[model samples]
Target: MQGDSRAFEAVIKSTERLVGQIVGRMIGNAEDRKDIIQDIYLNTFKHLPGFRHAARLSTWIGHIAYNTCLNFLEKRRLILPGENFLPEEEENAQASNAIESLIAHKQLTAILSEKLALLPPVYRTLIVLFHQEAMSYSEIGEITSLPEGTVKSYLFRARKQLKEHVLTAYKKDEL
Candidate 1:
């Protein structure tokens, strides 16, 4: 990212999906989410010169993203409902669809998002980093400043609570 625009651009293209997934879940306002994404990249570029290979490059970028989002949250002092940041083109395609299964999938996604949004930011961040981002416990700990054991424990409780929430809602739906 330093002195090589091509390298920086390539990194941005490759990591766009990862950034989208992270910021999308945490920030409700699409505008703010977009701004935060830019901020993450800018911060990454600014600090690129000082980066040591203490962690994987992706992991380092993830740290920048994670911290940028937290700072945005702290400054805003507001948490909005979590959203599945589907690509705009895909969303447009889905909107034009007529298939039943597609409709059901959309509904399920919406419900799941609602349940996920109800979680506290910490648990939601843990779940996203662990499950959605496919990060290791150690990676998550590095980002969240939590010990690996604590990450495991919080993830356990988060999963349990989510499962209970889904089951109870489904039972009520059945009734």
Candidate 2:
């Protein structure tokens, strides 16, 4: 994320899929997802200097993505009680089964999204960075300004919440 525009473009190209998935899960609509993705890129550029090598580039960009989505939600007053976003179409799914499969997928995604959204923004940010982006707790702490222990606690609670939600959904589906 330096020097040549090509480098920046490369970074975006590599990370766009992950960023879009994360933002799409947070913001839902295609139009808003695109807007939030653009905002993430812009913020990444603006904050690149302050991004010390304390965390992975992916984690750093993820921090930017989370903050950008929060700002967008705040600006629009769209922050719902729980995760209110929709999942994007899975590109690999076949046309015939797409609708059904997407619905099932969306249900799971929505459960996870709701649990994630219920967390405080700081913990939500940590969960996204650690689980979604596959960053280490230390790296997440670096990006979030939290202690490593606190990051671990947040992740633990996040996982517990997600587990409870999935279990509840599974039980409902069984009935």
Candidate 3:
């Protein structure tokens, strides 16, 4: 039992960040995120013995987190925000001072975050997995159960949409 507890602790330490990224991107509510993360960890512990070595441990854990979030969202009948999301006030805080370049960089990053929040959960997951986590298409496909082609296509669309939204928020003419 001590060995089991140590193994579980090691697993959580290694994969907690990956799980947090998935849960954070998919579920916006802080309270709901806590519940989802707890559920994910519980599920991971329950299923750990059954885990095969076919996939990377992080990828396997990520798959669990992604499915758990999907189930939670479905049960609650929640629809993640779509492209119609309004830009938050900070998005409009670009500066004109000597630090304009730095401020613009920060503003663009902020805009990307806001727009990313507006994407469908699938798109957000793909973006986070591919761009933020540096996972390849095959790895993402394994986690999402999407085909490699589908993963690539979805990632392309997500990037295109994010780019367009960011451009709209921070006008190209302003650069």
Candidate 4:
């Protein structure tokens, strides 16, 4: 965003959907997600001067989004319960089928989120920078101050963890 408030507003408007999705997935409550989104915008505006334009603007904003969500959850003393943040509805057979589908998606997402959280902050940040934000390994190394080899290793480990979790979950479902 430029120094202009209108420009910043435009950026927020354009990115709110993405920001909301990230925040919603992390926090899982509509009101809390909105609060977290506002916090992210405020943090972005506050830290705008420190932004060196070394990364894509979206990547920069995404970094802010991730941190904001984490901080909010931390402040609220929340634990990342291993449940998919599916919409609440009554339990009927059709609803059960829908819930299963939603839970399957949520389970995968939750497992990845939990595994990523288990990683050290540096590894987690790099994994998100590379996978979630689609940054190049070199770019992640630059952003994270890690070697490219380290970035690759961390990504490999993270992906392996995700694979194991998903496979185990699938097997449990099958039984």
Candidate 5:
């Protein structure tokens, strides 16, 4: 990635944040995020020459990352379930009040992520692209091969599903 120097660095600098955000939000494992990002750049470099003026270069890179993440998730579906999502060991160093708050926040985040993971990948993807990536409906549609209207519908449904899940989770906690 460093050999092409200026052009390559510029491409990475411009696109890396979105790639990281996409990969981080979509992929569950922190360890795998780095590898997936490296793979995206590698694929980008390999496919760069064939890239016609089809769409925005950033969108192209995002498509690559998005597809790669989906493939990664598909391949690891079985192994993922057995994985433990324990909170990090760093919590021990904090004060008791801070530790309690941290645990509560972590529990909420975990529940949300679990609920997010339950959505069909397409729905989850639209949510991530629209909300996390802040992409336009047309752009998300281009990446997903769906029409803009379809993208809007899916995003709406996905949000509704998440809302239901969050409320259900809180209700269960109350009981």
Candidate 6:
């Protein structure tokens, strides 16, 4: 039992960042994030014994995290926004203007982050797993339980959305 606990600890330590990234991108609320993360790890530990070595350990854990976040979102009745959904509250377009200025000031990374936050949870997850984690389409599909084609399609759409936002938000010189 001691050895089991130690192994589980190692797993948690190694995958902490990946889990953080997954939960962070999916969940906008900090308090909900904390509860969801705890629930994720608890689920991971509870099911660890049954885990087959069919997938990489990180991938398996990531799968759990992804599903957990989806469940959380579903329970809250909060659907991920598609292209037509406007953000719930924005007093004006200052946020957009601020992003543009951030781009003009050579803060491209920050500007991109702001835009990323506006994306739907699934799109953000795809971007994080594919770009930030450098996971291949197959691996992402496994974690996301999406077909490879769907993963590719979603990723392409996410990138396109981001591109459009960047282009329309600022003049070419700003970039």
RMSD of each: 9.7, 9.6, 6.1, 9.7, 9.7, 5.7
Candidate 6 lDDT for residue 114:
83
Residue 47 displacement in candidate 3 (angstroms): 1.0
Q: Which candidate is the best by TM-score?
A: 6
Model 6, position 47, has a per-residue lDDT of 88
| TM-scores for every candidate against the unseen true structure | 0.76, 0.62, 0.80, 0.55, 0.71, 0.83
* Residue 60 accuracy (lDDT) in model 2: 78
User: Residue 8: error of model 1 in Å?
Assistant: 0.4
Worst 10 residues of 4 by lDDT: 80-89
Can you rank all candidates by TM-score, best first? 6, 3, 1, 5, 2, 4
Mind giving the per-residue lDDT tens digits that candidate 5 earns over 13-129? 999987876787677677888899999998888888888869998888888988898789878772221153212223222222332333365576566777887666566777878
Residue-level lDDT of model 1, residues 91-122, one tens digit each, is 23323333343335447656667788766566
Candidate order (lDDT): 6, 3, 1, 5, 2, 4
Model 4 steric clash pairs: none
lDDT of the structure predicted as candidate 1: 0.72
Off by over 4 Å in 3: 1-3, 80-106, 171-175
What is the C-alpha lDDT profile of model 2 across 14-59, one tens digit per residue? 8886677557656757898887788889878877778788767876
Tens-place lDDT digits, model 4, residues 1-175: 5577998898798767556545655665778777778888988888888889888666577667877776776787665322222222333443223334544655656667765554334445555556666778876665445588877876776555544444445557667
- Number of backbone-clashing residue pairs for each candidate, in the order shown: 0, 0, 0, 0, 0, 0
Report, for every candidate in turn, its global Cα lDDT versus the true structure.
Answer: 0.72, 0.65, 0.79, 0.62, 0.72, 0.83
Model 2 poorest ten-residue lDDT run: 86-95
What is the Cα-based TM-score of model 2? 0.62
Model 1 regions lying over 4 Å from their true place: 79-110
Segments in model 2 whose C-alpha atoms lie over 4 Å from true places: 1-3, 46-55, 77-128
> Which residue runs does candidate 4 get wrong by more than 4 Å?
1-3, 13-25, 73-132, 141-150
